[model samples]
Target: MRADRLVSLVLLLRRRGRLSATTLARELEVSTRTVLRDIEALSAAGVPVYAERGRHGGFELLPGFRTELTGLNHDEALALLVAGSRRGAQVFGLGSALASAMLKVVDALPESYRDTAAGAVERLLIDPETDLLSRRLDAEDLPDTIVGEVRRAVFAGHKLRIHYEAVGQAPKWRTVDPIGLVTVREQGYLLAARSGADRTYRLSRILAAEELAEPAQRPDRVDLGRAWQERSVQFRTGGDPVTVVVRVNPNRREELVGTAVALLAEEADADGWLRLTVTFQDSRHAEWALWQLSTNAEALSPQGLRAGLRDRATAIASRYATP
Candidate 1:
């Protein structure tokens, strides 16, 4: 609610005097424009919030002004309580801060709700490292120092200088206006723009990062979900996409679809096998997917792929024959 957010905005300024709109937005998880509007709303409501103008200028509350408003309700506190103890967003480098905030919330909670909230959080699990199969989920080992720097830049709305190592390429320096940060399946990505063109960088691939003081070139209000979706579409359609048809054991169907960009079709065969048409990033990706299935899968078309697989098998057989 705007009212709850306004109270938070004021409280933030009270605690950390003279915070920039960008910083407040980062803390409140809103857009800087929204933060600016909230500041205006506070001023209109006769709050002693004043704005200073200059390089280090920001909004600050008048000394001695106090409010007894508790911005959070039972549900709000519990929601934040749950998220504060989770491991999901820790990849963005706010772990300690989250823990501290959770502590404060717990302390401020009504005595009746404190124990209940704690009990509720204890029953829930999030972002576990291992799955039901006992297989460990892949998590990028990101350095805290680098991620902290990048996180600061993204929230501060500043240009970022990164020493990046893209796949199959040497390390290079690149400056970008960071739009947002995203983590998927335990991997982190920075959504940014370079020279007005959208670009995405893997956090694990960043060799180094420096937050620039210069303001970023970006719209004030951002919809990260929409931006990410558009980028994902471009990536899926722009690659050297290859469609391949293959027959696989029904039990291993998931293994095949998991690596594919798109599953075009699927049907069962008379022999109890499954025929699937899937799209991969490229011929190499298709070839690799089929090879992983070993004898359980066969390419139904694209004779080049069949010949390639057969040649590979022949070499393997020859290596073992009478050796």
Candidate 2:
């Protein structure tokens, strides 16, 4: 770990030219004293690192001094390249930074492996805007300023005031104690609380945000996964849940079940259909999910949902009937 820190110190200086011990400590998640010690170790290894004194002074690598110290193997290099291709970093406002870092990694790679690895990565594709079904999966656009403030608040443990537009609701301003920021399926969410009650805000839905001077009222360290899971469970069960029994084509079973909040039971029939007891947040949710499967799935029970679908189909048929 010490060795890794030393190499990282050299790279940080090489890239940024100069950075104070305090800044380095913050970036490396260490201490100013630890950073000073690492600098000593790097210089002892003849790395041509020097320190400048004074308030604005910091550590820097000698002009034109570059190190071939990335030490990333072929598989690792490929993995980084693939990750760059996904453009996931763009969501966090790090697209340009990720690109620059990838270029540096490539330049630091061994010459013989570099060309082969670069060529191999060209054959791989990830997160294309349109999938095989021609369905577009583009991510929602978020203002850099809003994401920046929200991110700063979460990391700095500060409260944030946000102007948010919840679904079917008017825009309103609220102050929240941010717990964490999470991105799932390219959608960003800010998990926070208002007045100590758990609340989750979609980052894209936030029109504006400002980090507050007051520190957030939250745990010093949060188990984000557990918190998110607890919130997810609450959300899944908080609403009026509707359960339905459906017979789905075996081939489309996953398509049907994937949209359900939970699967209570399942059984396969000799006729090649699967019977599933599925729960959804409500009647509208249940109807919408099964409607996506068209005729492949039949809602067996809960005549209300069946009637809703029938009415919807009739409305569509009337639009084209003998027209």
Candidate 3:
């Protein structure tokens, strides 16, 4: 606990620049007395930690005292730099600060490790291209303070209160137990358990978030990784499965069935035409499938889907008809 407190204290000082004993105790979840003792230990270790006693006074790192990172080989140093550079703009906030801290760490390393570190850097080149910039998430627009708090709560198994906006409604406040953070196409989403149900919330929809006083309760058994996978939009649920059959010419059978109709089961006839059967949840899905296989395949079963397709075709043809 002391070591943890020391580490946290150091990070807090580095991040906030200063903190009162009360604030440090609250953040570290320890007593003020404990904070004082830890400060003493840090000072003893040549950390140059100092405290001020006044209305506006608190603990601060002495000016010109730097915490250097030592013990890294060249490869490790290079790897760290490369990883930091690859993080892009998000790092500008947290990543840049961390990279700066790492530089201090690298400076403390012995001369013997410099070559190893240099070798590691030479072994790999990191090029975070400008074109890929669009792929990075825009964390700048998000609340800087709460984003990190929400992340901590999620990882620490705590609950959160969020003001969220759905597609067609004004933003409303909701309480959810944090589960996981999902990154999709460079957007950050929070997979949370709603207060009264087993549903997840998206972080992008969250207008604001704060941690709750009560600790989070874990499920009897949790498979967070599996739950994340099952929540993907591609996972199907609750639909009447209808089978559709299609006929394709032999010459284009391989191209059509292999690429376009591979999801369906196919059978080839002696005349070089292929008959294919596929099951879909709804008429719309079937229609979409037909559109993709247009001209290459013809519907052979489920008269309803065929009729709908025909109706759509008529409507499309009528649109271009001469007056």
Candidate 4:
């Protein structure tokens, strides 16, 4: 815990410039004395951290201290700049600083590398329609901490104890033999072996984690990447497939099929309407599709699904009806 706090304090100082011992203590939930001790330890470790004593003074880095990066190529440099720019936009009080730092790095690059960097920056684009900031699945949004542990365990061939909350299930503590971590759809997941069985746990759902003293023996032929791909396939396949036929107005036909859910087939009627046969994982998908289509599409399928849609539509229509 002390080590974790110390590391967090270092990162906080790096990101926020400087803070007083009292402020650091509050942020780390430690005593002021502990913060002072940590500062001393950091200074001993050649961090160049120092305290300023005065009404308007706190703690600050020794003058001329700077973070240095190495081994970055032209494309890599541009990619870093683009990423920093995007993050700066999302985070308040950070954009201008990040942009300025990126500019310094770009300006320092040789002329031979500048054109490549510029081209890479122009090609790096993010879709504004997509939600960049997603809701946190776990109570504590400590992805970096979780990821760091996973990487260490995987490298050391160690076991881990994790408190996890599975979807629709109560939180429970479990022991896992660390294998590898996977990133899917902007979420980090752990592919670990528990009780001789391989399983994937979303890192976001991990409440807490700790490394075990004894390392577990990894399988000789463990293919971490393949395991993640197989698990993804299984997840997508487990959902109950439901077929729904919808009649959409010709003008709205393209919109109806352009949804995220997989579409099976579509046929146009002579009267300028389209009949689409689509298969979705669950009723939620069907509901979303109907919502997107609004009045232009009608569900025609298994009696139960059709009736449910009709009921929902009736309720929604009644809300806007004349009193």
Model 2, 127: alpha-carbon shift in Å? 1.5
Distance from true location, Cα of 212 in model 4, Å: 2.2
Clashing pairs in 2: none
Regions of model 3 farther than 4 Å from truth: 1-146, 168-170, 219-223, 233-235, 238-243, 246-276, 279-282, 285-323
Residue 281, candidate 3: how far off, in angstroms?
4.9
Query: How well is each residue in 1-323 modelled by candidate 2, as lDDT tens digits?
Result: 78777777887887788999999999899999999989888888898988899989999888998768857778879998998887567776667788998998899889987998899899999878888999877696888888888888988999999999999999999999999987777888899999999999998899999999999999988999999989888887667899999999998998988888899999998898999999998898899999999999999989999999999999999999985
Regions of candidate 2 where Cα sits further than 4 Å from its true position: 1-69
Candidate 4 steric clashes: 0
Q: Which stretches of candidate 4 lie over 4 Å from their true place?
A: 1-73, 83-108, 111-140, 184-186, 196-198, 214-229, 249-265
lDDT (Cα, 0-100) at 35 in candidate 4? 89
Error of 1 at 162 (Å): 1.0
Candidate 4 lDDT by residue in tens digits, 1-323: 66666667777787777698888889998899998898888889788887777885677777667655344566567777677745323212234567788788888888888778877777776533355586443222345556566567777888888899999999999889888766544456678888887688877788878887797656855776778778766664457777788888888876766652567887887888888897666777677777777778788776777788788889988999977
For every model shown, what is its TM-score relative to the native structure?
0.71, 0.75, 0.51, 0.55
Clashes of each: 0, 0, 6, 0
Order by lDDT, highest first: 2, 1, 4, 3
CA-RMSD of model 1: 8.0
- lDDT tens digits, residue span 1-323, model 1: 89888988887888889998888889999999998888888888999999899999988999999988964676877798877766656778777888888889999988888888888888878767898989897877788999999999999999999999999999999999999999888888999999999999999999999999999999998999999999987776676888899999988899999888899999999999999999988777788889999999999878888988999899989999994
